[model samples]
Target: MAAAIGALTLRATRAGLYSRLTSGVQGVDATTYPVLSGLARVGPVTATKLAEAIGMDRTVATRYATRLQEAGLIDRRPDPADARATELVLTAEGERAVTALRGAMESFLAEEMATWPPGEAAAFAMRLEHLTESLVQGEAGRSC
Candidate 1:
């Protein structure tokens, strides 16, 4: 019963988070956020490498990159190291969006966690990180 309740709670929290994030973000889908985040983190990288790093198929990753580029959130340039390959970089606007979304998400989470002890929040974060690693490392989109 406790495990069932925990599962339900996790599902509900994820829904609530998407709702809140959607309200906060303008002209962006939650699906695109992670791609933008990757661009921000890794600077410029080839689409193939970015796709591998993000655990998505090359074709799907290319689609996501195209969408992000259409939204002016990312720029694709010819790789200096390999002129035939393209490198993805976050534009200034994408950087702003990333920062804004990060802050909004943090604020939302902090609000939700206000009643919980700091240690509990830390533990929760650690557990989520572990789960994410398991998901990514085991198989793409398996644990999620």
Candidate 2:
């Protein structure tokens, strides 16, 4: 019962926050933030590698990369290891944007959960993490 209620609340709050944040940032969408942050963390990387890393389809990941490129948040450079492939890198502007976005999201989550005691948040996180892993594993099992 607790897990169910927590899941519902988390989903609703996430939707609300995404709507609010997207409205504030022109030309930025859900995937944009993750892709930019991923690039920032991983340095330059191929779209194929990034797609795998982020668990998105190649086409979907490509679209995100294209959108980021269009917004000047990311740059596509020729891969030195593979002449035919391109590596995605975050621009300075993208770095700034992603850093700000991370801070905002963290702050928002902290505020929303502030009333909850510390152990409650950690327990919620652990359960959610397990749920995510199970779901992914189930998909992988069926695909095989």
Candidate 3:
């Protein structure tokens, strides 16, 4: 299972599909994709929480957040709960980017599964999501 996942990642990287997918939105690479998606999932979060949610270092999270803010995809606002901390939130543009990214990924997978039976494709997607959720929950702090 691990090998299969790794192989899929390698193939995507080699094919530059990750870059292509991000390019469909705002020229974000694979690395920034996680940050954007993380914000989309749980925005108005401190950099530390965002980092934890995405399995990224706090510093890197801050950097990515900065870039996204500059791109107008994300915005940094004062944390009401913590006067000294800033919360990261996705802007309208960020939401659009996330939506576009999802579309790009779904389109790619849809193309790949076009030849497969509908039931098989659905089952594969469900199982993969379950596996990923389990892995992520079990290894919260570890990058997979």
Candidate 4:
């Protein structure tokens, strides 16, 4: 399982995969994928918080947030709780880009699984999702 997960991670992290996923989606690339996808999952958050959430450097997060802002894919707004701090939120365009990315990923996975029996693919997907959820929950618990 560990080897399989590692292989999947390696494959998923390849620039070619990201390039394919972000194709036709302007201003998005492997560098900005974590920022955009992190925002999609966690909603509005400060760059520092986003960095923490995504396990990236704060400077990198801030830089990518700036790039995304310039591309008009994300917005930087004053945090409601703090007048001095700002939060990054996806624009409508960013949402569309994320949707496209997700669709592409799903299509890619479907294509990869095309050779497998449909039931086996479905079961694997279900188990994978469950495992992911459980791991996330365990991490959340450990963080507390």
Candidate 5:
């Protein structure tokens, strides 16, 4: 199971896959996609917090946040909770990029599963979701 998971992770994270996924989205590549997608999931957050959530280095997150900000895909605004620190928020363009990325990924997966048996893909998706939930829960338990 570990080997299979590792192989899948490698294949899914390859540069080619990222290029394909981000084809239509400008200013987004493998290095920056995680930050963009992470922001979409967690909403406005400090770069440090976003980095922690996405398993990226704080400096890397801050740097990419700046790049994304320059691209007009994200905005850095004063944090409501902390006056000294800023939170990263996705702009309208950023939201659109996320949507496009998701659509592309869905299309890619559909193509990959084209040869699968009628219900097999759906079954696999369910199992994958369950496995992800279980892994997340287990990680939480360990952290506590």
Candidate 6:
């Protein structure tokens, strides 16, 4: 599933929309904002947990987090519950970036789907939401 998603993602931005939209940021790419948004969406969490939630390897998640940290987009603070662990959270800058990224994506989607019938787009979004919820539930079942 990840492989298929990865392959699709690689081609999804072939037009370089993400790059063009985020041209001012240094060392930030399409992956950077998504990872940052994932962190913000999940709130404060250990890198390992965040990785699992985002379907990324722990090492890769750490690398992304580290990059964002270096870029001042995120901050890592000591976990109050765990002495040896750290919690990742989005910095103010990160939050702004996530907000902008989400807005941009939504705007782009709206324009692209403007020609589609309203019900069809709504149905597609609903179907996607249901699928995502099912997957999350299935994972929770397995974890328990």
TM-scores for candidates 1 onward, in order: 0.76, 0.80, 0.79, 0.76, 0.78, 0.74
Residue pairs that clash (backbone atoms under 3 angstroms), model 3? none
Error (Å) of candidate 6 at residue 110 is: 0.9
Cα-lDDT of candidate 1: 0.77
lDDT, candidate 6, at 112: 92
Question: Who is ahead in lDDT, 5 or 6?
Answer: 5
Could you arrange the candidates by lDDT from highest to lowest? Answer: 5, 4, 3, 6, 2, 1
Is candidate 4 or 6 superior in TM-score?
4
Which model scores highest in TM-score?
Answer: 2
Report the C-alpha lDDT of model 1 over 33-117, residue by residue, as the tens digit: 6677777777789988887777677887888889988988788889888878999998888888778878887887889999997
How do the residues 1-144 of candidate 2 rate in per-residue lDDT, one tens digit apiece?
A: 777757766967667766666555655676576677677777789998988877888888889999988998888999888798998988887877777777787888899899998789989889989987887889889977
Query: Which pairs, if any, clash in model 6?
Result: none
List candidate 2 stretches off by more than 4 Å: 1-16
Clashes of 1: 0
lDDT of each: 0.77, 0.79, 0.84, 0.89, 0.90, 0.80
Please give me the total number of clashing residue pairs in predicted model 4: 0
Clash number for each model: 0, 0, 0, 0, 0, 0
TM-score of predicted structure 2: 0.80
- List the candidate 1 regions with Cα displacement exceeding 4 Å: 1-16, 140-144
Model 6 scores a TM of: 0.74
Candidate 6 structure quality by residue, lDDT tens digits, 1-84: 787656645766543776765665654686675578788888989999999888888999999999999998899999988898
